[model samples]
Target: MANAASGMAVHDDCKLKFLELKAKRNYRFILFKIEQQQIVIDKLGEPNESYDDFTSSFPADECRYAVFDFDFTTEENCQKSKIFFIAWSPDSSKVRMKMVYASSKDRFKRELDGISFELQATDPSEMSLDIVKGRVF
Candidate 1:
């Protein structure tokens, strides 16, 4: 199917793989660049709660996610940008969430942003977990 934003063709197989990884929470990060019509599932570094402290050692706008970047760039580029947010749940079983805005690199920069991060960070009592449990297309 053609992605509305970039008109880039995305195959069903690719979408399926993306969904599968998301549901399983198997990937450390997922980048859906509309211009490429490609969903890149990344297994980056380990999840660390001390991300904030780690990023603080670097210069401003550098290493927003401590060791990772909003654009999912290499360690070098991650030290050059700071346009992302990281949050942690207050419950006993704390959960960490990262939020960022993304779209076609050549098109607008903030398209397809916030929704997934909001949903992921939402209080379990506010929304039905079933939606996340099933196929989310």
Candidate 2:
């Protein structure tokens, strides 16, 4: 299917969800939880990924968290880190999705933006969230 006047697909909600708080029409939309979208947060080299696990599982949960400019075209350039999004569950014993982020490149290239991501939490007892998860797409 397609939009009435636009040529875009009609069923790409999930892909469109990644959109930032941008304005496209005469009105504006505000999400109650903006931290769950593909918005940018910081470039402060996040807290070293919490690396507290020695037996964490592979293929762990990797949400497309944080989108850096990374304009690698100058000598004074450096890797930047931004928060952009969060998906953490406030009431979970395990390391829940506190937030998520991704690249400005839209690496996944989904029609709708992604919310918080989830992994199996293989070693829920022996992993630090920064280490167990926190890898952006």
Candidate 3:
């Protein structure tokens, strides 16, 4: 129930459940956005990786719109917690989210999107290209 649009990082058990659902059906790859101003998916792939291979893996330009979910309970109450779905977009950066998902991870749901990124090897200073909010989306 968290970041349903993109995908959630759940515990190993939760991950199993998620994978089960994923394999069961082709729900929807609703396009989302990059919530983070900058993301670094350093493993862009191998030395001779082809562009199509990269895209097949996950295009650097593509992104998923998502929301965060949180709860205040310690353990027992945790079961009541969840961040539900809102919508998805291939280009979340193009627009501002219309709603807030929740607090904590939920707090970040509408704040922004996430992306894969890497520092410019030639200029690690990041001044030349840090992938700002306005550009890459």
Candidate 4:
């Protein structure tokens, strides 16, 4: 019986099945942008050196806090825009993510548009932002 079971497991079809199962187990992080009544899903790339620089200034205990900046485009005028995401977790399990849209001319200043959301999954598949706050400055 042991020989028979091992033979079944060694089959090519069984190997393919295992590979498919492993692929399904993988998860990806998603970025969402909500403007007006429409919600857009944005794609995120790997973290850059700036992300490392930003986090290095914080203490080791504060590693749960992170900031991600990406390039995005506005819906109204389809103009290119830049966004900064600030995520923090007190326990390192549940994270609160905040979004800040920056002006093209003055990237340092935060715009009126922003969004906030929460994440509790060990590996989140998605994050969203609502652009209702308008301009703050």
| lDDT, each prediction | 0.29, 0.27, 0.28, 0.27
CA lDDT, candidate 2, residue 83? 22
Better of 2 and 3 by lDDT: 3
Worst 10 residues of 2 by lDDT: 25-34
Residue-by-residue lDDT tens digits, candidate 3, 22-129: 343221112233344321122223334433342244323333322212122444444322222222222322333223211223433333323122221112122122
Regions of candidate 2 where Cα sits further than 4 Å from its true position: 1-11, 21-79, 82-120, 123-127, 132-137
- Residue lDDT tens for model 2, 27-137: 112111113332332122222222222122122343222221111123446543222332222233223333222122233223224323323232344234453234433
Error of 1 at 70 (Å): 13
Candidate rank order under TM-score: 1, 4, 3, 2
lDDT (10s digit) by residue, model 4, range 14-99: 22322332233121122323232222233322344333343333332221222233334566556442334343222343122212
Q: Estimate each model's TM-score.
A: 0.27, 0.20, 0.20, 0.23
Highest lDDT scorer: 1
The TM-score of predicted model 1 comes to 0.27
lDDT of 1: 0.29
Which stretch of 10 consecutive residues in model 4 shows the poorest summed lDDT?
Answer: 1-10
Answer with 3 or 4, whichever has the higher TM-score: 4
**True lDDT of residue 42, candidate 1:** 22
Which scores greater on lDDT, model 1 or model 3?
Answer: 1
Which residue runs of candidate 3 sit more than 4 Å off their true CA positions?
Answer: 1-37, 59-137
